[model samples]
Target: MRRSRAALMAVVLATTASGTAAVTADAAPASATRATACPTGWGSLAEARAAATTVPVRDVGTGRHACFDRLVVHVPGASAASLGHRVRYVDRLRQDGSGRTIAVGGGAVLEIRVAAPGYRPETGAPTYPGRAGRPLPGVDLTGYSAFRNTRYAGSFEGETQFGLGVRARLPFRVLVLDGRVVVDVAHSWGAAR
Candidate 1:
């Protein structure tokens, strides 16, 4: 009749790792309708690994939950072992690997950077299938309410970056749970909208 903490955690891990950033049990009531409160400046670098790795089969997905729209990066590995991550809403985007500017469609850009090498150590091949397609185009956000688009900016020097095009720079939250990294953008700044 009850779920164990470990099982619950595993469920959360699987959901987020599958690129489904569902509103957790502790999240504000869905009926509230207003965008959930996501304090900005929630960026942090992994503390365990001396460096980052790009050995993740990155997948993208979005879901329009009751309170927010979610963008998830399903990295299948240890959070500490995968990559040191940093998330922020930026004015513009330049690929971390190339320094070239990118044209993303959105009023605001949420840059998700992980300090991981996007390539194997010896072979020099990319860790993900992004060498040919920069954006790793697979996810479909066709009728989503908030997410505009996503771009695989680039990965370089033990780091990878992606840009999230949102309707605007609204409140957002990032989570590193087990093997998943999540980014959820609020649909509205408040209930007034």
Candidate 2:
């Protein structure tokens, strides 16, 4: 009877280990899934931040704080080009099932080509409940009383310029669960082509 009990315990341990492994495999892609396309000239977020001059924060909410950054690029034989802007905001909830999200934007560079207010996009937003998937649909950006009440993400594809200049705005509400990045609430603003 003791030997039989030991065998049963070993089986339970093996099953639990396998379940944990499966969950980790499923989570490998969530972080990479939430990235936006940087401007044409800039390669990465760090590079863009290096060129940007720090600005003041706006719109702080409960458990949330916001900060802004601006970068002015010197154009050839002309006025310096304002590449884009970034807003970094974070919210930490202390309640049960709490989490954190991050939002980064390349500004109007990713605007949908032919979107008008009150018009839905051809594609729907991507939904990822902490699983392997692509970035959430930019279409979710519709109807948020945004910078100009415009459709920031969709099929639009031209200058993609919005806001004060070329700077893209990326707003995110992240949830931190037990010190890990999970459940992201991200928003962006862009103009039509």
- Name model 1 segments beyond 4 Å from true: 1-51, 80-82, 131-135, 191-193
Per-residue alpha-carbon lDDT of model 2 for 1-78, expressed as tens digits? 466446545644653332211112222222344442322221212111112111111111111001212211111121
Clash pairs of candidate 1? 52-115, 52-116, 53-116, 53-117, 54-117
lDDT of 1 by residue, 20-93 (tens): 75545544233455433443442222222234554654555566554567776656674645555778777777
Q: Which stretches of candidate 2 lie over 4 Å from their true place?
A: 1-105, 108-167, 183-185, 188-193
- Reference-based TM-score of each model: 0.69, 0.15
TM-score of 2: 0.15
Considering every candidate listed, which one attains the maximal TM-score? 1
The RMSD (Cα, Å) of candidate 1 is: 6.0
